[model samples]
Target: TQLLEQSPQFLSIQEGENLTVYCNSSSVFSSLQWYRQEPGEGPVLLVTVVTGGEVKKLKRLTFQFGDARKDSSLHITAAQPGDTGLYLCAGYTGANSKLTFGKGITLSVRP
Candidate 1:
């Protein structure tokens, strides 16, 4: 099984909609980060929660880390086309320091 998996690899919605993408794993992590990347740009860090049960919110986006530190979630409220992009979740552990990325969720919000 994959180390990390995300649901709904693709999402399409009208302007002013709401949606959520989930990241799940069987292995625990020291910390997990959420990132949003636009075409031709690097993935920008949206949120990073290290403690279990931690939650962070940025404008219309909400982030949550599972109590077991094995999963995370991102929820968007009143999503606009401007909010459209590639949503990715990454987990970090050990000396590798390499992030395990989700298959990627492509969100397209149309007006």
Candidate 2:
């Protein structure tokens, strides 16, 4: 099985729409980080939930960690055109700081 997978590789919606991106894996990770990246610039860390069942919110974005640290989700509320970018979830093995990333979900929010 793939190390990590993401659902709905691509999504396009109008402004004010709601959407959820999923990341899944069979292996457990020490910590997982969620990032939102735009063209050119590197990804910016959105949040990192280390504890199981942990939930974090940043503005209109909501992030949750699975009870087993094998999965995670990102939900966007009333998404706007500015929300359009690449959403990536990365799992760390706790050594060398190397990260395994999901396929990624590309979102396009039209105004």
Candidate 3:
């Protein structure tokens, strides 16, 4: 079984601050994805990292995949109250493989 671990399960910050969250696993994944969820809504895909050492950026958010494909991280710059939400990391092995998710991190940005 594949399991993902996320660090700093909860975070609170003032608007305009920066934060980083992490996800790790012992198993290798074919692809890794990050998502953000708002209250009463399903998670929205943020970015997907496939190649090792690959990095993707969306506005103030950045995503990276580990060189060994066993970990990932998300960094947010100058966070805003609108950035408050649940962040999740999910891994995919293949088409027939079951998807595994890390214990999500909840972020609150107080204005």
Per-model C-alpha lDDT, please? Answer: 0.91, 0.91, 0.92
Ranking by lDDT: 3, 2, 1
Number of clashes in every candidate structure?
A: 0, 0, 0
Two-way lDDT contest, 1 vs 2, winner: 2
RMSD of 2: 1.2
Q: Which scores greater on lDDT, model 1 or model 3?
A: 3
What is the C-alpha local distance difference test score of candidate 3? 0.92
How do the residues 1-111 of candidate 3 rate in per-residue lDDT, one tens digit apiece? 429898889999999999999999998889999999898998899998999999999999999999999999999999999999999999997675677888799999999
- Among all windows of ten consecutive residues in candidate 1, which has the lowest summed lDDT? 93-102
lDDT of 1 by residue, 10-101 (tens): 99999998888999999899999988899999999889999999989999999999999999999999999899999988999765789888
TM-scores of the candidates in the order shown: 0.93, 0.94, 0.94
Total clashes in model 1, counting residue pairs 3 or more apart in sequence or in different chains? 0
Question: Which runs in model 1 stand beyond 4 Å of their true positions?
Answer: none
Model 3 misplacement above 4 A: 94-97
Q: List the residue pairs that clash in candidate 3.
A: none
Q: What are the per-residue Cα lDDT tens digits for candidate 2 across 13-102?
A: 999999999999888889999988999989999999899899999999999999999999999999999999999999886566888888
lDDT of 3 at 13: 94
